[model samples]
Target: MEITMYDTLLQLPLFQGLCKNDFTNIIGKVKLHFRKYNADDIIVEQGAPCTQLIFLLNGEITSQATDNQHSYSLFETFGSPFVIEPYSLFGMQTNYTATYKARTNINIVTIDKLFVLNELNNYEIFRLNYLNILSNRAQVAYEKLWNSHIGNTEEKILNFLVLRSMKPEGKKILKIKMEDLASLIDETRINVSKVLNDLQEQGLVQLSRKAISIPALEKLTEKNK
Candidate 1:
């Protein structure tokens, strides 16, 4: 589906306050690209070169991380105008740190690194905007790393789930399996199960044979606090 220039800028968080003509100019520089993927499609692999800045126009995407043998889902989902990793755009590192996949059909707009570099060289405002975006993204990455390396397993699991809860239709009933939880928490399934059982025993969650449900989200969040 073709999108108008105005609609593109409106969907972008960084371009929210810009006028219509400014959006038109930006859109002229950006090349809109569409990709349709089946469920569980890998969009970008970890350690692969990240060549463009992407703006999601439709559908859902998730990012996962892998360190050699182990893999963990970084975020349950990302939708619309969310830049993959802005830090790579300015020629820091090229490879994608996380593997991204389509949870549903995805439509994206791409601005090539060369294109961004050329534009930024001339447009001070756009350069600042891009840099600010990258700075914020880097900070988030740092925080996630700090938590994973220093925080306890239970804290990590709680933090990860709390973030997932912000997604659309995200709620207490987590359908994710023990293996996925173990991956996210960097724990073995046995240990994950034990902690989950502890949370269940405390009335924070309800774990059935198939799915786990959080009876009190507030209580689950209290662990994070």
Candidate 2:
């Protein structure tokens, strides 16, 4: 069967539990803006006023943030249909926290903030779903802040491992290159490689060409304590 836009939106966290009739009600009430982006397109820049709640319907997008040193760091990459920066829609200073760029040809659906507010007031499920999504994002921000305070390279590596491995799909394996991993942690590739070598010797992880497999995730988590 051919899936419709409503079907895709239903799979997203914001609309997960919402039925077709609920979606129909939403469609009837809000004017959704659709946009198509080619690879390398800037979807939204950091500090730009956030006037709409954007939902990525197809393709991939990368979010990057600049630190105090003016260095850009990769914040996240979203592949499936999901809300982008719902927290930015509110607050006194309503702006995007990071720059979002399309990594491939992308399609997006956007709803105005006023309409979103109305929906939140009208639908209990959407309000709960949005709150849960925001909470998860806040937790991730907390982890990044916590990781930044660790001064030891080995400890930082362990913390990074623990954080990523906590993900459901990242339970045993971390499929990332040493260079990219180094960039993520703001360390040199050599330093990351040395730490991985030490981890391998300690039987904490098994390293290959493109991935690092943790034999015992608890071993890495225990080191963080």
Candidate 3:
């Protein structure tokens, strides 16, 4: 069982460069923590303090962020071997930016910040991997902003979603009213509605009252490109 766990750790981003020997040493060094959740279970709520590095081992989960005024929530789904916002751990706003929930039976392993600071930091490879991930996230965000521009109403909406997304490709859910969404994207309500209707007709999104469900963000991205 421990062997399987070590192998799984190797697949996780934060532990990627570490060899089997390193994982074994870490396991022996700390009281490893594990947790599980059933489908639809809430793993963590938005604004909660992030005191540990939470790694999703298997299954899928979604992270949701709400606008400050609680206008609408943005959600993005990700699969296994995921890390839940590692950058939040040491920032001025130490709270998790989103609420995360399980989309399947999920298993997670977490390393407390203290161990990450005192012990994991001692490993040169581990420190480099950590720094790389943080740097990559910042760089991606910076580059994406340059790509964000107002095009057609459809492209405007797509850019809005993609810019806020954790990953460019995933299942996405945008819960906002037509007027609110239109105002945010700087499009007319009628134009927004017309484009959304056209998208729905094309089977790209399923629209209901105040919600737009995108089953495959990648498919829509591919179609546009």
Question: lDDT of all the models against the reference?
Answer: 0.65, 0.75, 0.88
Candidate 1 regions off by >4 Å? 1-5, 69-75, 141-153, 156-193, 201-219
User: How would you encode candidate 1's per-residue C-alpha lDDT over 1-225 as one tens digit per residue?
Assistant: 235745764657555556666766765776656556766888888888888877776777877654444332334466666767666554657788777888887776677877776763355566667667777765665665565534666676776655444322233555566887777667888877888899888877788764677655667766667
- Please count the clashing residue pairs in each candidate, in the order shown: 0, 0, 0
Cα lDDT tens digits, model 3, 108-216, are 9888999989888888988888899999999989977876775789988888888888888868999999999898888899999999999999988889999999888
> Residue by residue across 46-158, what tens digits does model 2's lDDT show?
88999998999999887665443523242456686867788888878799877889989999988998998876448988999888977887788677667753767777776
Point to the candidate with the largest TM-score. 3
Global CA lDDT computed for model 3:
0.88
Off by over 4 Å in 2: 1-3, 68-72, 139-152, 157-193, 196-225
Model 3: per-residue Cα lDDT at residue 70: 43
Clashing pairs in 3: none
In candidate 3 the C-alpha lDDT for residue 35 amounts to 94
